[model samples]
Target: MKPEQLQASGRRTLEIERDAFAGLLERVDAHFAEACTLMLGCHGRVVVTGMGKSGHIGGKIAATLASTGTPAFFVHPGEASHGDLGMITPQDVVIAISYSGETAEVLTILPLIKRMATPLIAMTGKPASTLARIADVHLDVSVAKEACPLNLAPTASTTATLAMGDALAVALLEARGFTSEDFALSHPGGSLGRRLLLRIQDLMHTGDRLPRVAPGTPLTAALLEMTQKGLGMTAIVDADDRVVGVYTDGDLRRSLEDQIDLRSATIDQVMTRGGKNARPDWLAAEAVQLMEKHKITALLVTDDQLHLQGVIHMHDLLRAGVV
Candidate 1:
């Protein structure tokens, strides 16, 4: 086949899958609602099971559900029959996926599932098939035809199944009032989690590493502290250790423009007073917002009493993946 022919065939395949998904959307009815309700009301985890191509879609659906505030995991139907069924409890809800609705391994476990009185939700192309007939809720994911030219591959049907699974996850997420913070908790090591859940306290330079100078400290001394701390700035504090001002690279530039004597000038004389600051408890993501809003690179972290706690640079947030 020519390269152009291959491209054409691939595009047609995608078009078929896209239309199949649209068909599934139009077919969604009260059964989809009932499926969502069953999963939402489930006190235990959602145990997803399937075979073959449907199994791959089931794994992805389980992951999406788990990450979106629904506790869920995938279990291969064949494995479920061989003691993996122990993972399923009476309190849990079972979501079974099979394009034909009569996959042997899947059907083999239906009796055991029913005997446990576990709520069964089936995603299938044939509503009248045995799996659908026995399910407490049936989500119809039927497609007009397979995307394969031969009409044998599970292409369009699998696409429809995955789309339906996403719809159910999103609906349950909304009904449960699942927030981004909740999502972050489930994905603490991912970039989104870092951006949503990381706080200034987790990334700030604190204690002795926090560059600070007394209000009357000489500019030369403050510059030394900033250099030693490598924070590009130093917080100027009063005798009470309360933040009084900040001296940054910008201040150094202005001082040079004015030919201010670094030896004689004190931090209070040349520092920017009452500059923007953040609380240690503030989200690092929020700190990035503040810094971008002010077009600044660093911020002083303070406690409720306005006492200097630490300092955070934009670089810190970038390294922490909050950017």
Candidate 2:
């Protein structure tokens, strides 16, 4: 095809797929809710199975369900008949996808699934097909036409099926009140998980790693503690280790401008009293918020009695992937 024809073909394909997705809106009726109910009430996993192109979509649908708080896994229909059928238990719910609704492999396993008394939800374009007729709930994913000019490729139909699967996952997600924290727990390696699940205690410098000094300590001693610990600041605590203030690089800059005697002045005289602080249990993201709010780069972690627990710096958050 020529350049213009190529562009036109791409646009035409998108238009067909867009309409295919739009058609699924009205179809998200009672049957869709029933499918969600079945999967929600499932004591075991939601087993999805299909053949060919539908199998690919089934795999993605199963993944979405699993990540969004509904435990699910994809079992290829072709493999199910061979031996994978054992994976589906009586307590499990099965979601079978087949636009044609008569995939021989899928049909071959229906009798066994029926014998186990497992609830079956079928997504098909043909409501009269055997898969749909026998399904406990049939989800109509019919598309007006394929995006393929020859009308043979599984294009728009698959798009509709995928959207329907998303609808079910999201509805069930909300029904279960799945929160971002729950999602983070499942995706702990991802950035969102790092932000939501990483606590300040996980990254803060504790024990001797903390830079601390008594309130009466000279400015030179506090500066030495800051340099030795390399946290860009040092916590000023009382004899009992209760944090009273903090001395930061910014404070040093101000003291230099006033020409204060760094050698003779006490830390309590120049330190920022009751500096911004965070609890050890706070989310590292919350520490980022406190740092941003105060326009500072470091914070002291304290316990209920304001006792110094640990210290966190901007670099710590950056290294922890929580910034």
Candidate 1 Cα errors over 4 Å, as ranges: none
Show the lowest summed lDDT stretch of 10 residues, model 1: 21-30
lDDT of 2 at 302: 99
* Residue 218 Cα positional deviation in candidate 1, in Å, after optimal superposition: 1.8
Each candidate: RMSD to true structure? 1.6, 1.5
TM per model? Answer: 0.95, 0.95
Instruction: Write model 1 residue lDDT over 204-318, tens digit each, in one string.
Output: 9999998999978878899999999998999988889898889999989999999999899888899999788999999999999999999999999998888999899999998
Q: What is the lDDT of residue 213 in candidate 2?
A: 93
What is candidate 2's lDDT per residue for 45-153, written digit by digit as tens? 9999999999999999999999999999999988888899999999999999999999999999999999999999999999999999999999999999999999999
